[model samples]
Every structure is written in C-alpha cells, then in structure tokens.
Target: MTAVSLVDVASHLPPERVGREYFERYSRPDDPLLRNPMFRAPEYRRYAAREDTGADLVERAAAVLFERHGSDLAGEIDLLVTHNALPDVPFLGSGAEIARRLGCRPAQIVDLHNGHCAVFPYMLGLARSLMRDTGARTALLCTAQTAGRIFTQPGVRRSAHAAVPGDGAAVGLLRASGESPILATEVRHYPDHAPDVALKLDDGRLYWEPGTSEFDVAFDNSKAYNIIERGSEIVPEVVTRVCERIGATPKDIDLLVTNQPNRLLLRNWGAALGIEAPRHFDTFDSYGNLFGAGVPVNLDHALRAGRPAGGGLVVMAGFAGAGELAAAAAVRLPGPDRPATPTTGGPR
Candidate 1:
C-alpha cells in the first residue's frame, strides 16, 4: 500500500520568453528539425542568471511553494528529494543543498537521477518506500533544470537540438497520509534504447547528441530521429501499464500529465492513449523542456487552472532522455474527508 498524498505544488520559471522568432533569427532555412513545424516550439521560459547555480533555481522554486504551502508543512518535512539533470555544482548533492536552503535540517535528503522526464513517477514510489522504512511523515520532492546556459550557447546554436531545451524548477510537497492517496506507481527501464540521447564534451566544446541508429555509430542528426521514433511507442506503453496496475484504464484517468517532448508529440501521445485534447496538460510549448522539472511543473499548471476535478484520478507519466527509462503513477485528488481547495493546488 502506498502511503503518500501530494498536498501542494509550485514552480519557478525564468521570466524571459525566448520565442521561435528568436531561433529563426539565427537558424538556416534548411536546418532540419530546428525550424520544422512538426518539432518546433513557439517559445519557452528561461531563467536568467549571472552566478546562480541549479541550486539557486531549486531554492527559488521551493520558496515559491513555501510561500503558498509552507506554513503548515514546514516543520513536518522529514524527507527531501531533489532531481536535476545538470547540477550547478560538482560532487555536492542538490538534495542536501535544497534541504539546507529550506532549513530542513533533520530531514533525510536523497537525489533521484532518472534524467528530467521520468523522475516524478519514480520519486512517488521511492518516497513511499522511504517513508515506510524511515517512518518519515512528510517529503519534499523537488526538480529543477537550468540547462539554458549549456544547451543554448554559441556551440549548440548551430545544431538541431538548440531549440528544444528551456529552464525552470518545480517543488511538490507529499505527505504520508490517509488522505488523497496514491493508488499505484510503476517504473520500467528500456536500456536497449539508452543510446538515443546523450551529451558529450568533445574537442573543448559541448554537444548534445539526441538520436539512435541500427548499429553502433557516432553522433549526428539521426539521434534525434531515433528518440522520436522510440519515445512515441514506449511512453504510452508505460502509461497504460501503470494504469492497469491501479485497476484503471486510460479512459478512467481524468488528466494525463507527462513530459514536454513537444506540443505535437504530446498531442500525438494523448491521441495514442485515447485521451481527449483537453484532458492532457502541456508546458513544453510555453516553457520548452525543463528536464526533471517537467512533470511537477505541468501538474502544478493543471492544478492552478482547476483541472482533474474533485476526487479526480490524475495520471502522471514521464520518459527520460536515455529512452530506456519511464515511470507512471495514478493519484486521486481531493480527499474524502475534505473538499477541494485552490490554495494548495491539491486535495484539501
């Protein structure tokens, strides 16, 4: 039995909006995926920073969440989980940094490393296990990414991958409670597809390699194509399996919140899952991909907009960059003993 209920959620998005026009200003007409309508995003939010690290983004996001949900859970947080694809600091853990920043001294801190897309579902299951083992009462599950500095730099500006990533962070407060329970969580790794996405620092310059091949080969544009081909199939499979684990179907889910691959991919995924257009929430179009922060940030967006009605069953699913990893979970919002409250963006 899972012993977790998400009580509140919040995120911090860099105020700057980098639109497609900005990309067009630097893109060549024949630059394949960069300008293609099928893969292009109109704009994405990027946090502007001078010396701040990924830790800063995580702290700012948590602060936003605390501003709204902190008073009640501040002292109750006994566990802290942080996830980030690119840590601003080397060797040191973001989880500990976040815990220290929030002054959660007694809380146990751990970091989830399943890329940016899939950690939410993985974290849910992990949090449940941790609480049961440690007897912790509350867990702060947080994710943030500030890859704009790396992915949008001059070296990447000439590649097809430059247009896909953005920056932001999200924090979710999950408590061990009988209220607003988590029905089930499922995770699977397809390491066979792990080669689809990668980042290499070669020749004194960094390059994001995102694609696959039939045989072992070096980097190129096909890597991106490989991800598109493979991701389209596995993401939906994991979502469905997780739903079945909870004795539910895609039709039974009120809202399907997954990673921000792109608006087109998300729409296609929704269609593949037999979900209606309105039932799925996406921030990829508006914020690009915030990597690990994608799931929680999108969930917060839906909650703020009053989605997944009272007692609604919300399905959260995500796939990481490696293509081998995926996770999904089903949660029912608005506890039976309490009514829906907009303040927490969660069940009351």
Candidate 2:
C-alpha cells in the first residue's frame, strides 16, 4: 500500500457574489416543498465567467496551484484527475483539457463523471492506487463547476427546487508518502435513489428535478426529505467504517470537512458524529453547494484558517444530492516529526 501525502490545495471562485434574496426574487419555485425552507441557503458566490467556460475554471485553479508551488511541480506531477458536478459540454473532457493547459505531457489524465459526492474521495483512492502500482510520483486532483451558467437563459429560472448554485474550481496536489498518511477511503452508490435528484430539460429549458422518491413518498415523506435523511445516515457510516479500518475512533479525528449542502446538514452531521462544531469546516452559507468542488475548497479554507492541527487526523466526507452516492477519507497531517515537504515535484 502506498502512503499518500497531501502536498497542498488551492481554489478559485469568480468575482460576483449573489445573495439569497436574488434567488427568491428571480428563481424561487412555486411549490411549497421547494421553498427557502428546503433550499435553505442565504447566499452563494457565482463565478462571473460569462465569457469563459468550465475548462477555464479548471485551468485557472490549476494555474493557481502551480504558481503557489512554482516550477518544480511541472515534471513531478504524473497524473491529472479532473471532473465537474454538472455536465457542461459534450465530447470534451475537462480533465484532459486541464492537463493540456498545464502541459503535463507525461501525466496520465483520467476524467470522472460521478458528479459532486463521490468524485473527491474516489479520486484520492485512485491516485493512491495509481502511485502504488504504476510508480507515478504525484497526482493533481481538480474539480470545477460553471453552475452560474444555468441562469443565463430566461425560462424555467424558477423551476422546482432550483436553488441558486455558485461556480468555482479547486485543486489539490498529492504525492505518495507517509508524511501525512491517508488511512482509509471508501465510496458507495445507492442506485435506487439515483433519479430522485437530477437535471432535466423541459420545453427547451433546463430544470432541476428534486424530491421525487416514489418509494419514500409512501411513508408520507418527501423525496428531498428522504435524500437528506439518507445522507445523514451514510456520511457517518462511512466515517465509522474508515475509522475502524484505520484503527481510529471518531473522537480521534481532529477535524472534519464534508461537502457543503447547507448549514443545517453540516450541523446535523457534526452532531451525529459527536464532532465539535469547530471541527467541521462549513462554506454552505457563503459559497452554496459547489458540488464536487466543495470538499477540496472547504479543505483548503480549513487548512488556511488553521482549523486542523499539525499531525492531526482529518476526516473528509461527501454525498450526492439525491443521497445516491457517498465517499469518505481519513488523513493524518504531517507534524514536527514528519515535516510537510515542499508542495512541488518530489515526495517528502
């Protein structure tokens, strides 16, 4: 097994910040179930990428990571894993595009289509496996979203549960090492609820389909309710499984960061896991649901804010909108005994 080192993480968001009142005035739905109670957010920053595309977001984040690390990362990064929460274009893969933009000619590029929840943890595991088996030195994991583009058109802005989405991109550099051990990683899929949450095209307009769980509705519960309930269940379960596999307990983790659905979900998850409020890093109120970008972006924010201790254990978790997919990873930060290496080409 290869020990993974988290070199560093970088993120980028567009300039325009939109408030909840803007969504309520222009995009709120008529269905009572889809009201602000369910949307449950105050504001989200939109990437002002009117003239740009999803690839631009990915490239910009990659550029930030490279600039922070300097020229050393150019040849050392051997793999590029790129993905986005929503499908922005057909035929072209964003991961490959980012790799091309960075001129990482020797790096193997893999594109993931798992959307928001499963991608980050899944990529972490894959990068570890690739480094272990293929002798790759480093891997760059990136998640980008151009979610604000959905509102560019006129019709169906008030579609069901069409809570305003923010746009952004995040990147992390990982290398094989024991300096910051990634204890365990897991991802699970629940196909039964796959269709409960999705994007649908209707009458030449894009609309979101939320809370349509047929089986759960029999219990007099909304599909959105069931999705949240299932998320509340699975995140903790995966955290427990990872802890047990690594011979660690929930109490042993020093920090927790999960995908941002809303402030309420983060609070509920912290309560269920018995983690203190400060241990969990939250960006929901400010950034909205960044989809796949949430985990890395929040992790970057937490690390920069000095939330996690040196040599401390950090647990990262994420779940899909319909609660159909889930993933978690446990990592121990480098401490004085094992100083973090320069986040460039070489392993610590």
User: How many clashing residue pairs appear in each of the predictions shown?
Assistant: 8, 0
- In order, candidate lDDTs are 0.74, 0.73
* Pairs of residues at least 3 apart in sequence or in different chains that clash in candidate 1: 116-291, 116-292, 190-324, 210-223, 210-224, 211-223, 211-224, 212-223
Local accuracy of candidate 1 as per-residue lDDT tens digits, 258-306: 9887776687788899998789888776888777788888898898887
TM-score of 1: 0.88
Model 2, 34-79: lDDT tens digits are: 5434456546657545776777877787787787788667677788
Which stretches of model 2 miss by more than 4 angstroms?
27-29, 34-36, 151-153, 204-221, 343-348
Best of the candidates, lDDT: 1
Clash pairs, model 2 backbone? none
| TM-score to true structure, per model | 0.88, 0.88
Report the backbone clash tally of model 1.
8
